[model samples]
Target: MGLSRRQLRLLMVSGFSLFLMYIMYSSKGDNPSSLSDSRESANSIISANPNAKIDEAINNKISKLYQQEQAEKAAEEKAAVDAAAGIKVTEEIDAIEEDFDPVKELMQIRALAPMIVFSKSYCPYSKRLKKLLTEHYEITPSFFPVELDKHKHGKLLQEHLAKISGRATVPNVLIGTSNESKGGCDDFLNLHESGKLATMLNEWGNKKLSVKRLETPSNV
Candidate 1:
């Protein structure tokens, strides 16, 4: 029983129409506005139609976007950590005086240079070092007691001296003579322990006295 060519053609057309109607109905059944709506629809279509290229495209885009965002976030977090690590904290200075002359002080006593001790009132090491200076040696007014908390001047002075002397720390002790400047509390202690502070002071005083002799005009 062979069907006529016209009948076969008509039957094929009907079947194709049914498939097209099914495709249209399935596509319209789900909303396409939100990601979740699209994802659910994609999943349903993929399960039913494994060879769907359109669903695979959408998934690839989503995965690529996720990876890019994760890398950017990781970079930002690393930058924050590096910034925290690189941060430097400086010691705070309270106040600076309006009229404080360093030159006049330096010139007096024929340049009888002071052992400048940068100090903070609450610092125990500074206190102990000061006590040691007083106990072991003759600390004159030239032994400048610079309080870092009381004024910024002390901190500035300490910084200036540090740069000139090639060292940086608190409780800094300096012995500036007519010709040379020696640094550090430990150095001073070493000299003092070795019975050298007295000798050095005497030598400095003698040098100043000799300098005065050179400066004065002899009554020939």
Candidate 2:
């Protein structure tokens, strides 16, 4: 067919517009042909290897077994670690028990003097009792003071003291060689006010153990 010049010019303009659109699409990375080629290649590979399906099943089974084996190994390792930790803890406890005897320790502390004051440094009542004993009275034998908070085995001592004395709180005042606790700070105050402390000290001692009251400032 013989085309007119105007028709040929219009056809060239349309062809140039189409080419521009294709260049824009290519720059934007749209590739349907590449996707189709990948699918064809995969199909060709599968067809060439007829036992591809069977091989895939065997690979999946092997992977699953490997995962289960790794999981079992991890579990066993965790159990072994926990057992070792438990054993170490048990051994440490046994060592402490072998080294420390609360009963024996308490007995030795009690035998320090005729009178012992098991106290905590921070307690208000313990402080008051200690002040009165140390500052006010002078006996033949000075009273022994044990600050429980300062002791390494303080908790064990306090527990054992509670069992023996039936009192858990501090400023635990005990008297005589038998470790007799008349009571804590409040009880001692009552005894001091009643003039019983002086008399008791004299009577309980091997010799005449006088609790000589010291002269101090009247304001104190």
Candidate 3:
């Protein structure tokens, strides 16, 4: 028997609905299995490859090395900055030293007299030494008195004196042609008391006199 058109249409609709449900069910079932199969395949590959962990370890080591290299580069840059700053500071100090060269001033003073007395104007010890030398010994022209505090390069001179003489105090009495005498007030007083000061002055005076006599033209 032949079906009616409405009944045939209803049957076709039911069949189409069943087909859609089956498709949905098949998609849901296939997605999970496909995901599981992919996971299992990945696991099998990892198990077969013995060096998977070693590759991971090598990647981790490379990452660590990159980090260490970055850290070392930062340290080197910091050290370079510190070194540049140190050099600038050193240059500034050298410039100051050159500006106030005490040695040059000392040489100029030495040229004036072999016997030099480094002193300060207001110092009592300096006054005492000056009086002793000028009044008692009468060694005026050959005796050179440098008032350090009054001089332009006084501070630098003091620094140099401290280094050379091992004493930076006033009334630094330097005597003889060799300029060997390096002492303070006490040394001067001791020399005076011992009468060595008189003897030294006489000897120095005789040498000067002889030199003058030699310089004078002979009666030809």
In order, candidate lDDTs are 0.56, 0.73, 0.67
Candidate 1 on 1-220: residue-level lDDT in tens?
Answer: 9997556745655565555556644773644888888887778776766345544644565566567668888999999987766552211111223355444433442244445566678887778767766555544444666677786355555565566556666665545553244545576567656656566655655543211112222221
Q: Is candidate 1 or candidate 3 better by TM-score?
A: 3
**Per-residue C-alpha lDDT of model 3 across residues 105-162, encoded as one tens digit per residue:** 7777777765788999999989987776655554545577899999866878877877
lDDT of the structure predicted as candidate 3: 0.67
TM-scores of all predicted structures:
0.38, 0.55, 0.47
Where does candidate 3 clash, by residue pair? none
Error of 1 at 185 (Å): 2.3
Off by over 4 Å in 3: 1-97, 177-179, 201-220
Give the alpha carbon lDDT tens digit for every residue of 1-220 in model 2.
8996556645655565556455433432435368777676567655655355445545565566567668888999999999999999999977886788888997788677777889999999999888877787887678888999999878888888888877889889766655456688888777777767666666665463457767764222
Q: After TM-score superposition, what is the CA distance of residue 209 in candidate 1 from its true location, in Å?
A: 10
- Rank candidates by TM-score, best first: 2, 3, 1
Report the Cα lDDT for residue 209, model 2: 48
